[model samples]
Target: MLKEERYSVILDLINKKGILKVSDITDVIDVTEVTVRRDLQDLDQRGLLKRIHGGAQSTHPIKLEKELSHIEKKNLNLDSKIHIAKKIATTICDGDSIFLGPGTTIELVHDYLNVNNVKIVTNSIHVFNGFIDDPRYELILIGGSYRNKTGAFVGSIANDILSRINIDKAFIGVNAINDNTITNSNEDEGMIQTTILNNALEKYIVADSSKLNKRDFYQFYTLDKVTAIITDNNISPENIDKYSKYTKLYF
Candidate 1:
């Protein structure tokens, strides 16, 4: 491609990654090492980035909040997350034991599930109430301290209950996935989710395409931590290829 196009790609990478190694930019932009280095110099000189040892850090740092408003998560990708939720539900069969996490996507999964006789164990109060009262499904709510805002169980009791159960597949929620790690927005949620994943036979992280390749605070798992991902086709090809090395990626 053209040299100008390579520079445009560099800026896009910085926006997504928040930083980029010189060598990594070379690979991403498909330019010679010297050409990439010169492009970084131009960007750095223009006050776009602060040069680091091997990479350039964006002048715009990404800051993550502990709590995002329910509206924020719900509105992030209304249609794409709906598609992801549907794909996650389709993976299940009748009589499978499933672990559903607390998040909008998993709520969508719970909302979409017509699968019969699935024993769902979760600490998410929303997921509990979504199916708990229904006769078609069996709901197990792990007892623990409650998080009113997110409406999930937190602390030791939740962990203990998680340790005692075995699940066929876990429908997990992720805040972001970048730098090869699955991160969550809240620390306490990460703690509970880590325990949930440890006991499951297969794990599936259901996130909208917007969360893909975006790293935020509090990593709960890595790319290799889960078996597969259910997301929409909005994912960047670069990221899909990057994560595919570790897990099966499905839309």
Candidate 2:
């Protein structure tokens, strides 16, 4: 492909995912890191995108809510989610009641859970399937209405169920985070998450670094509401300082 063609493709990728690694762009555009960096620089100069340490991000910080299918999200930030999930597993102890909110990152957390005799409350179908047959966990499925788009339960019934249950820790996920506030695309999903956080004794927000410094529609909670944030180490030191004052941060 020509330089112009590669530029268009790179821009398109960033627009869809909000962030893209230089290595990821190079592999797709059949170019070297030097070439990708030049493309990103040109785009950055044109005010189309912002260049980061190893990737490019949308110039605009806030993103409107977009409904993404579960399959689409399954692979978007798989590695980062896996790393965050592994660390999250170590923090849970036996016989604790936890709430796993609906999100791709929270679903992955199920894979790393090894603690015995833990009670899990969740509305995510993916999380339900992950441990439906496991004997070690006592799973509580917060059933109500199912939304095929997100493959999760959401509605007043789900909300009421969560209100009655006490949560030791709530692992919540958001579509985006900006200026210490968490937001999501769907109001119903966001409302359910709000209830989970309110009912929990401790709240932990689990998201990949890509979700940081970005915003989605329907603001839910501020960083001060959470106990700590669990994410990948790709987060910048500047951000750590900005958010650490409000809540504990774990990268």
Candidate 3:
């Protein structure tokens, strides 16, 4: 393929997918890894796309949310998630009733939780299972329409259960957080999360650095409404300054 043709194809793919790995480009456009790398570098320099490690993502400030299955996300940024989970666990006090939202990071929080006699509420089957075997926590699983992709229960049934619950602290995960807005890909799940956050005495948004400065399809809640955002220390200084202006951040 000609250089111009390769550039066009690369641009089209990145714009459509929002993010693409070098292998993704090579799969469509017959090219060597070195050539793809060179093209990505050129595009990054021209400001057509943002060149990231082993991949390129569109330059659009807000891209549409893409839902990944729970297993698909389990290993992505595992270290960052572990660090964030450890930090969040420390904030939990003994005998507190807390809501744990659905996400890989949130699931890890259960492992680090050492507090005794805590009531753990969740809409995630994965999260519920994490604490089910342990006698340390009082587990409440909210049942509704189950989303197999995320292992979360959504819809009105879950919302109704959350409304009656008195939660001391609510830790919810999100797809994206840009400026003051917090968003998620699924509307039903977002609705349930919003309800839990609203009913809780303390609301916390749990996410890694990758979730920062992004936007999803459903704008469920905002940063100002939450007690603070718990993220990994890998967040850039610029992002820390920008988000700090909106709400408190714990890294």
Candidate 4:
């Protein structure tokens, strides 16, 4: 595997398990102990984690929103995102007006859409690009202050546009999911997501397994607000039971 791929997997493992030994990481990935230690050190220097005696741990609860480049995020959780997007596409129908929030997972939903004469409303430039050249769909790009890194529109303008329209469904993405509450990092981004949910007749929180059982900075909406959630098959049966109490779930 490439060095960067190893780094991403190691970071994901640390985040999920809280701490990991060098031997454990090497066992999971096809890398040696020497290489794992070096990778950990590199991630430590980048402030992604904290290196310790024999392993590494997460830095802290990310309370503040960190704007990462879209390119970087697009490469993370790719397989899970693709699976979730395919599941989401199964629900779309012709002549449907849907709201999609900004996230790499949500962006992939565009690929599996097979319907024609569909109208898509979104604040994500990445989401917009997927349908920009296709005439089968009508695209509505919500305008506002641009967040360059995320390629998303935020602020009052985006919210106002969302308020004026009533969508058939809203496929929202989130940074973290803790218990029954769904959250994101930035307050501005959270506001736009929340507003879209409020205006939609049906709301679907589209996320991957990595986002579950964790909490981010801003709590936008709870599971009760949505009609259902669409996640990847990797979600555990334990989580399915916990989240099912609040809303219907699909993979």
Candidate-wise lDDT, in order: 0.80, 0.85, 0.91, 0.86
Ranking by TM-score: 3, 1, 2, 4
The 10 consecutive residues of candidate 2 with the worst lDDT sum are: 58-67
Top lDDT hit: 3
TM-scores, each model vs. reference: 0.75, 0.74, 0.76, 0.74
Runs of candidate 3 with Cα error greater than 4 angstroms are: 1-61
- CA lDDT, candidate 3, residue 104: 96
lDDT of 1 by residue, 115-190 (tens): 7998888888877877867897888888788887777888887887787888899888887877567888777788
- Give the local distance difference test score of model 4: 0.86
Report how far off residue 188 is in candidate 2 (Å): 0.7
lDDT of 2 by residue, 123-171 (tens): 9888888889899999989998998877789999998988788889999
Report the lDDT tens digits of candidate 3 across residue range 147-234: 9999999999889988899899999999998777898999999999889998999999998999987778888998988899999999
Question: Cα lDDT of model 3 overall?
Answer: 0.91
Candidate 1 RMSD computed on C-alpha atoms after optimal superposition onto the true structure: 5.2
Q: After superposition, how far is residue 104 of candidate 2 from its true place, in Å?
A: 1.7
Candidate 3 lDDT at 156 equals: 92
Candidate 2: which stretches are off by over 4 Å?
1-61
- Model 2 TM-score (2 dp): 0.74
Task: Write out the backbone clash pairs for model 3.
Answer: none
Pick the TM-score winner: 3
